[model samples]
Target chain A: MRWRVIGLETHDAYINMALDEAISEGIRTGSSPPTIRFYNWEPGAVSIGYFQGIRDEVNLEVCRELGVDCIRRWTGGGAVYHDSGGELTYSVIAPAGVFPKNIIESYRLICGWIIRGLEILGIEAEFRPVNDILVKDKKISGSAQTRRGGILLQHGTLLYGLDLKTMFSVLNVSRQKITDKMIKSAEERVTCVLMHREAGREEVYEALLKAFTEDKDYGFGAWNRDELVRARELAEKKYKSEEWTFLR
Target chain B: MITHSSRKVKEGKIVKVEVDCEDVIKKLRITGDFFLHPEDVLDDIEKTMVGLKKDVSFETLVIKINDIVKNNDARMIGISPESIAEVLREALK
Candidate 1:
């Protein structure tokens, strides 16, 4: 099967999540091919899982003060703070039948591409069960997946940099003041590409793009008009609405 | 009263429960980092908690959740019916 590969593009939180959902819908109806896209979040953002409580996971006041956008994801997972230049996010949307029916096995298969990508940078990482990629026991990446209407959509982030202070500020880790010790504690459990090797963001993206496309029949592609139209609609109507954001 | 509790289950996921109740659960909300496929099954899980006595047994809660989960063929990753039940019971307390 041929796969569509879209290179890195920048968008806000709402558009990023909306595009994934939109692509899933397209793939479900056979209007679009299986797709693998990499993207960046601009102005930064904090995204909580679908079932997550916004108040429990994000500090909206802090986010607004910091000029960061906050939104909920369509998939289930922990909350993530996507810094503009701190991470590279990727999404794989295709028919559910194309992958293993077992969730863990499928996560392992898709996350393997990440492990290979990191390997190209000389950073050896391992996939932790459910949905995490760790380097030396510290998390370097995380993903979430949701299968619907015969389509499976999995999107995740690969940490390129660390901004624990801003990340902690936006996320509701605690009500206490941000402290060096707190950041230090998080550093022990989290990691990024910069922590492992010296490489530019473009180089890392290229490495990932290569690994993801390896052994697969894929070609560079772009979203069609239908996908763009649907994504914008979902971004404005569903993702940005108070009802969806506060669904919890 | 709105009672709330959260638990970091053994499987490394957090499960939070918010309940409004007197003698029986009036409303319940389950939220956290856990993954539940066919996510709408959450509605059924929350619905099952409603009208349950404040003193409902953990076993009973798990059974109620398991029935819905099994019937829907839903998959709960990083969490289980028992874990959700425990947090719900804790919130009621």
Candidate 2:
């Protein structure tokens, strides 16, 4: 089967997420081929899982003060602080029949591509069960998936850099004081490509693309007019609506 | 009246369950960041909980929860039926 690879582009949180749903719907109905998209967030954002309460998961006051966008994802998992220029996000939308039917097994199968991508960058990474990729005992990536109709959409982040202080500030951390030890522990837990070596953005992007396309039949593709229209409509009607973001 | 409680499980997942009962459970709503297979299984589990006796024992609740999850082939990542039952037990108090 031939896969469609949509190259990297940066957009606001609403549009990027809207496109994922719209494209997945196209794949579901056979209007478009299964696709893999690479993208980035422009002004930074915080995306919480589908069922998570934004108030409970995020420091909304800080987010507002800093002009960071906050939204809810269509998939289930923990909250994530997606910093602009700090992360590379990828989405894979395919027919459910193309992957394992079991939830856990499918997560392992899809996350393997992420590990392979890290390997292409000369980084050794391992898949930690249930949707995390670890490099030397520290998390380098996390993914989440959701299945609807006949399509499966999985999207996640691969850190190129991380602003630990900014991230902890936006995310809810019950501790009154974030001690030096706390920061040290966080650094020990999360890692980014920048911490390993100096690498250009394009180089990292190419390595990821190579890892994703290895041993697979794929070619560059663009969203059709119909897909773009649907995405815009969904963005306005669903994703951008306050009711949807705070529905939980 | 409905009673609700939430717990932050060890895995950083939240398990929030709400129960409405007078003598029997009139409603149940389960909401959280936990992943459940097939996605809609939460609705099924909620439906199953409703109409159950309010005084249902912890052991019985656990067995019922396990049966529901197993029968649906539902896998709860970062959250477990035991953790859910713990919340329910606390709400009952």
Candidate 3:
């Protein structure tokens, strides 16, 4: 099936989450086509999994000090630190009926395209079960998905670089686990594109774009006016509000 | 008394359970970073467990949880009925 692709540029955490939800709702109701969008966080952010309690997973003081936004995702998974300068995030909104019915199987199908993208970047990555992309046993990417009303929205981050110190400070890692040796060893468990190649963000983005469009018929598109309006409402009413973010 | 327990399952998926009970379960709140499709099944499970004895057998709890999951057609990934039952047993302990 054909898909519409958009390089959504960068947006803050609330608007980004709102757009994903709004676009998925549009496609679910047949008001828009299935879409693949690439985006980046404006000031970096920490997105906790849907089922997580914000206070339990994040150090809010650290986030505030660093000017990072903290938001909760619509999908269930571990908390992720989206670094503005170190990562690229992409979302795929499609009809759930057109994809695999099994959650894990759909993850594999989507991650396969990311693997191809990594290949073009000269970084060999493998799809680790339950939703992780690994290179030599180090995680390079992680994805999460949610399906509702016949629509599926899957979004994830690809590591271009990692600021381990900042990430550890913002996330809820135990104090006992914070050590030079620990951080050093942690590096062995996570890798990035810059660590392997001399590619910049645009190079990585181009590789992913080529991989997604390669062998498939796709068209460039923009968000519809109604979607922008709905997204703004959702961002202001749901995503940015403490009621929804701290609802747990 | 309010009893609480948290368990980290495979892939670091966490299951945190808090139950209010003295003899029979009065209330339960299950929270964590686990995937459960149509998430409302959590409410159904909590409601079903309200009147259960504090010392309910593990197998019975599992059976009850499975019944709700099946009846609701809920799909749970990373978290399992057994894990939820184990956490419940911990709370009851």
Candidate 4:
């Protein structure tokens, strides 16, 4: 099956999420092809799982001070701090039938591409079940998946660099002191690509693009006019609204 | 009053439950990093919890949730009915 491969692009948090939802709608209606895309958040952002209580997971004061966007995802997962220069995000949307029926099996299949990309960079990584990619037992990437109306949407983040201070400040880690011990403990569990190699973000993106498209029928593509319009509307009406952001 | 409890399940996800109850459960909210396909199944599960006795037995909660899962053909990863039941039990305490 032919897939649309969108190269790494940058957008604010709302528009980024809106585009994914829009594409999913398009795919369900047979207007869009199966797609795999890479992107970066601008001004950075903090995203919480659909079921999470945002006030419990995000430090809104810190986010406002730093001008970071905080939004609740349509998918369930832990809160994530997406740093513009420190992370790379990818999404795959296709009919559920194209992938394994078992959820973990599907994660392994999609996460395998990330593992392959890490290998290409000479960085060995493994897929930790339920959506995580780890290098030497330290997490380097995390993903979340949600299936709606027969189209399965899986999106995740690949850390390229570390910014523990900012990440912690924005992620409601206020109950604990932000000290050396905290950073040390976090560094032990979380990691990024730069920690393993010196590849620039552009090089990493190319490697990931190659790994994701390898042996698959896909081509570089762009969003259609209708998708852009829909995304803009969703961004303004849904993602940017208080009702959705504050939803638990 | 609202009672809350949270735990990191051995299955590898954080499960946090907040329940509003006096005698019968008036409200229940389950939040976590766990995965649930066709995610709205969670809403259904929470809805089922409403009107249940606050002192609902662990086994009863499991049966209630499992029935909903089977009915909806829902799939959960990094979490299970037993784990959610355990959290709900703790919140009741």
Candidate 5:
């Protein structure tokens, strides 16, 4: 079986999520090849899980004041903040049988790539159960998965340099609960690769690509013209719609 | 037994709700000054939720409550049945 690896530098959150969904749908429907893509979020955005309540998870007023976008993801997980300056996002879309049979095992296997990536950067990170990659007991990466139409899409963000204060401000962390000590504790708990010695964002991205696809043979492929059109339509009709983003 | 404190937002203000469920819902206290039409939607939601298994699917419960609210045209000030279901799901988890 041939695997296709393509890296995109998309900066818009809606476009990024739409492309992932499009690629996954394409692979499942036999319209596109299996793919892995890397991208970033422009401006900034907060993504909540499919079933999450936006009212409970995000401070909409703060986000509006700061000009950050808040959207909901199709996968299940806690809310996450993404910004151009802070994170590297990756998505893997493949047929269900392309990887291992067990779901949890598949998560571990995929997360192994992240672990290896961090290792190359001299940052010791471990894959936590279910779906998180942690370093020193704090999460550096969080992932979510969705399997539909015989295709599995697993995507996540790698924290390059998280803004803890802004994160707390945009998120619904209780103002009373988030004391200075609590903030310090959270800062100490969560870490980013940029905080480590010498490993910059570009370096981390390169390391991740190498870690995930170094041993596996990959071919270059482009989205067919039809796919590009359909993807854009989906982005306009679904990913960018208030109905989809505020479903919960 | 499940116990947790959840924040309820109404008009962008935060209010706290304390819940204690023992096997079934034993106590449902609404502490925040939020308004609900008919003044008993909370009790109705709680009653509908009472005796439900702790492991019951929260989504299903939310759906039921939503149906009830829609049928009665009840107003739930700052809290939605979905939000309540979310809190319950987190507690059970």
Candidate 6:
């Protein structure tokens, strides 16, 4: 089995989500090779889970006024905010037969890769089911997965930094449910790698690459021109559409 | 058994769904001004609820439906299960 990994720089949430969908679809339809991608979101955006209600999960008016784009993800999870300086996102696309058959098993198996990556960053992170990576009981990463057309796509984000206040403002945490104690409790439950380590983004990226490639025999490459063109088209035609962005 | 009503906006039009359900499953029929592709996606969602236990936490069922729609690339009229649950919650009130 061969692995293809690509490191992508900052892009908007729409573009990021579109690229992942395009790549996964491409692999499914035999238009592209199975791959892994690392990316960052620019201008910051709030993404709701597929099954979540926009009104219930996010403050849309606030997001509009603040110039933060809100869109729904193709995967199921709670709403999340992604920004350039806040987090690093990764997506892995593999043939279905390459991983475990059970959903939870697959999550654990792939989460092990994240654990290894964080270990390389000198932070001893552990996988916490059903979908989180934590250090000292504070969450450092969260992930979601989908399987289709004999292909598996697992994507996640690792916190490098966070803006909890803005996150709280944009997401629909009941004001009554968010006391000072609750805020402090949330802080205690979540953490960023930059808080504990003095590594730069590039260093962390390299660490993850090394970690993923260490035991497995794989090759690193870039997305071909055709795939890039297809991704851009998909971004323009579907993922970035108002219909899709605002769809609950 | 519980019956609930909720409103949703799809394609700039409002929709009202009336759901009758018990602790084990729900029977839903959506009505209002809206357009949906293939029309069967909604039916599929309703069918998925046939044997589901009402007490089983609607969140998990919604997630399951989301996964199915995403994988099948089904076109939804911008309605989400969360909206349905919200309507149900209000009905319970």
**For model 1, how does the per-residue alpha-carbon lDDT over A1-248 read when each residue is reduced to its tens digit?**
99999999999998999999999999878788899999999989999998999998999999989999989999999899999999999999999999999999999999999999999999999999989999998899999999988899999999999999999888886322124224445547789999889899999999999999999999999999999999999999999999999999
Per-residue lDDT for A1-248 in model 5, tens only? Answer: 67787765855777777788888778777888888888888879998766456777799999999988887776655678897788898888899787786666777888899999999888899988667799887789988776666787889989999799899788875443235225645456578877775666788889998887878878867777766777788878998898987755
For B20-77, candidate 5 gives per-residue lDDT tens digits of 6766566544333233444445557767766776677977878988987887776554
Docking class of 1: medium
lDDT by residue for model 6 (A76-119), tens: 55567776688888898888788987666787988888789888
Q: What's the true lDDT of residue A97 in model 2? A: 91
Candidate 4 deviant stretches above 4 angstroms: A173-184
Query: Residues A1-248, candidate 3, lDDT per residue (tens digit)?
Result: 88999974899999999999999989977888899999999899999988887887899999999999999988888788999989999999999987899999999999888999999988888999788899987889999988888899999999999899999889985332224225555446778998889998999999999887788778999999989999999999999999888966
Q: Give the residue spans of candidate 1 off by over 4 A.
A: A174-184
| lDDT ranking from best candidate downward | 1, 4, 3, 2, 5, 6
Instruction: After the best TM-score superposition of candidate 3, give how far the Cα of residue B9 lies from its true spot, in angstroms.
Output: 1.9
Determine which window of 10 residues in candidate 6 chain A has minimal summed lDDT.
Answer: A173-182
> How displaced is residue B45 in candidate 1, in Å?
0.7
State the lDDT of candidate 3 residue by residue for B1-93, as single tens digits. Answer: 998887775434678788999889989888787888876677788899999999999999999999999998889988899999998899789
TM match of model 3 to true structure? 0.93
Could you list the iRMS of every candidate?
4.5, 4.7, 4.1, 4.1, 12.8, 11.5
Which scores higher on lDDT, 2 or 6? Answer: 2
Q: Across residues A1-248, which tens digit of lDDT does each residue of candidate 4 receive?
A: 99999999999999999999999999999888899999999989999988788988999999999999998898888889999999999999999899998888998999999999988899999998989899987889999999999999999999999999999899875222224224545547789999999999998998899999999999889999989999999999999999999878
Give the number of the best model, judged by DockQ.
1
The lDDT values for all models are 0.92, 0.84, 0.87, 0.90, 0.73, 0.70
Residue A45, model 2, lDDT: 96
Q: Give candidate 2 misplaced runs (Cα > 4 Å).
A: A174-184, B1-14, B17-29, B44-55, B63-73
Predicted structure 6, TM vs. truth = 0.74
Docking class of 6: incorrect
Q: Residue by residue across A1-248, what tens digits does model 2's lDDT show?
A: 89999999998899899999999889877888999999999899999888677887799999999989998888888788999999999999999898998877888988888788778788989988778898887888999999887798999999999899999899884331124225545556789988886888788888889888889899999999989999999888998899989876
Model 3 chain A is weakest, by summed lDDT over 10 consecutive residues, at A173-182
RMSD of each: 2.5, 3.4, 2.7, 2.5, 9.9, 8.4
